[model samples]
Target: MAPGLPTPKKYFVTAGAAEGSTPLNAFDNALLAARIGNVNLIRVSSILPPGTEFDPNLELPPGSLVPTAYGYIISTTPGEIISAACGVGISRESFGVIMEFSGKCTAQEARAQIENMIREAFARRGMELVDMKIEAVEHEVKRIACALAAVPLWY
Candidate 1:
């Protein structure tokens, strides 16, 4: 955690896809498409803190260690549609929950699945949903392809 930084009061969601000659390059391209390619991603579990706000245009500096909850899929099978999605459910009590999914499916399906997961998570915790955020991406593989969705927490 960065010293003197606010307690991650804002966050953002992003999704993207890309194709390349290799799996690693495809994944990097996906990250570039998602506009977080240069940062060091510190992947965390799905949980949005109390009082957290959403920012659709949030940008972190290159090489920053960003904490995120994310899902991704890579496909080498030609013509395969790989998709990823993430959903967030904000509770009236000030916290939020996140769910992520990735598989060989349409982006819409992946998004729907994550949304359902978020709803179930909130229900299990007896939390009332006050807001929601969803993001999804899909890629059809010619050689190597990757798709990813993420919720990046900011301080």
Candidate 2:
């Protein structure tokens, strides 16, 4: 947490609208700025297009109201990994990623761990966290399937 920083803020993420969307809404624009600008995202309370609020803390369903967007949290790793995977000694400064199925319960289960992995990957490559842009949307088909399979059949 940074000094004099606000916490527990509600961010509204919209699809097909970056920062330049008509009928601009303060909440939506603020959320977009926070994410595009790489501000620490605490939690996304609500989203648009119906059935997108997937709150793990509350153990809610995949469809809450927040529509699937894509691209979640961006770290300093993907860039290095992409470069390394391609057999490059030097990598770019930052990498932009689209977190497929961010709001899907099944896919989101591994999100935290995956985020850590991304961070580690960047650290190994000797890169620092410059900025991150996350796209949140409905969970991907594959990720949802994986989550379903992970659950117990008797449940």
> Could you report the Cα RMSD, in angstroms, for every candidate shown?
2.3, 16.8
lDDT per residue (tens digit) for residues 1-155 in model 1: 65773457779999999997899899899999998888989888978989888888888999998888988998999999899998889987667998889999999899889888988898898888877889999888898999999989987
- The clash tally of candidate 2 reads 20
**lDDT at residue 40 of model 1 (Cα atoms):** 87
Model 1: pairs clashing at backbone N, Cα or C within 3 Å:
none
TM-score of 1: 0.93
Residue 54's lDDT in candidate 2 = 20
Q: What is candidate 2's local distance difference test score?
A: 0.26
Distance from true position, residue 129, model 2, in Å? 1.2
lDDT of each: 0.88, 0.26
Lowest summed lDDT across 10 adjacent residues in model 1 is found at 1-10
List the candidates' TM-scores in order.
Answer: 0.93, 0.23
| Model 1 bad stretches (over 4 Å) | 1-6
